[model samples]
Target: MTPATENPWAFFDRLYCISLRDRTDRRERARIEFSHMGIEMRVEFVLVDKDHNDPCRGIFASHLLCMKKAIDAGARQWVVFEDDVVFHRYDPHILKDAVTHLSNGSTWTLLFFGCLIKGSSKTGNPRVKRIRYQALAHAYAVNRAFGEKILSQPWCGVPYDTMLRELSDDYLGTTPFFAFQSNAKTDNEACLGLDRFRRCFGGLGLIQLMNEFFHAHRLWVILGHLAVLTGLGVCIW
Candidate 1:
């Protein structure tokens, strides 16, 4: 009898309707191209009503749903991303190698697949573990154990990156987290600037609000997005 093939990753994509409105064709082509490269990835469009009043809620809702779906798929190890981020043209094997490295070597609750920094700084940077933060959910990898841990906790009502910062001290070198630094400046598509929120609250306070929101709402902060979008728009329904 033939042996059953090992289940590939239960990949999750933290997509937004903006992708559909902005770049539908490129997105579809990218998905197909990645698949052809032998990366068993799946895109889960975290739909939120374009009319959902608060854009922040829509964005967060998408990620929360994406996390839940990844867990429901029985994903032990999964990669999460926003549709805006682009991948390197390098061989697919190289990408897979990086994923394997993070998966096996670190206990990082979340591994940034891409980073968008300008110069070199010693702040929370990884050497052998390189993927630095350049954009929002550019690409993050997670394990089922970690996924369950984060999911079980309330959504911290803040961007995922900041959320990691608070938890970073807890898992310093113990968790092998990284960010991609090479294509930080040149790669526009790969970077995530969150133009929407920037237009609304143009100041550092927005970040502060996010952090405070996460602290206050905790899980509900995260879960609120799920309900807001799911109710306002179509999602993991």
Candidate 2:
């Protein structure tokens, strides 16, 4: 994993891709996609069995395995990506930049390449931002310190991304998304889970939508839209 540049901290020496043994098609797809992005690496397949039937548990177990492997390999930090992840614009420089940035300290528990998160005050660095929520685990990097912390915890049955989110407020995400899951393709749709809210009228659905909406818009933009809507309603009345 050598970077094209002379920078000492440019590329991640240890990178792992988690794939399901049963999903050979996805495995092949991931291999090709990662290769295209110059991420030539080995895939860590997590075979499904009776004990790992639960998708959440399977994800958690796979991540834990990755962490252990990193520790055994004597890697100070490692990058992990799900098989379905698609690199945004497929640039090697961006990935290298993230590797360099997040490698700065052990306090940065996780640096998400792609996620659904509430926007927060921008950090001076464009490559990182404060993450308020993390809904996806498509791509991320963690250091040895965080890996040790993860190993110390018991399996709480929570989803892997949610567990990682609760572990620390130090989680950061790359703006403009370094990578994301390939959801537009039909073959890739199986990994997409049911929406958190099945019905908009349901209390959870409304809350989820509001949260997403508010997080996406700036305060002034939201207020301006509200005023325009109110004026339209009055004019119609």
Worst 10 residues of 1 by lDDT: 172-181
List model 1 lDDT by residue over 66-176, tens digit each.
668777766666665554444443443334444444445555566554443221223232232332233345456665676676665455555555555544332211122
The C-alpha local distance difference test score for the whole of candidate 2 amounts to 0.65
| Residue 96 in candidate 1, Cα distance off native in Å | 4.1
The lDDT values for all models are 0.44, 0.65
Candidate 2: 10-residue stretch with minimal lDDT? 196-205
lDDT of 1: 0.44
TM-score of each: 0.51, 0.77
For residues 40-91, write the lDDT of model 2, one tens digit per residue.
5544544433234566676788888888888888878778888777765445
Query: Can you give the lDDT of residue 75 in candidate 1?
Result: 64
Give the Å shift of residue 46 in candidate 2.
5.7
- Candidate 2 wrong stretches, greater than 4 Å: 1-10, 42-53, 90-93, 103-106, 184-217
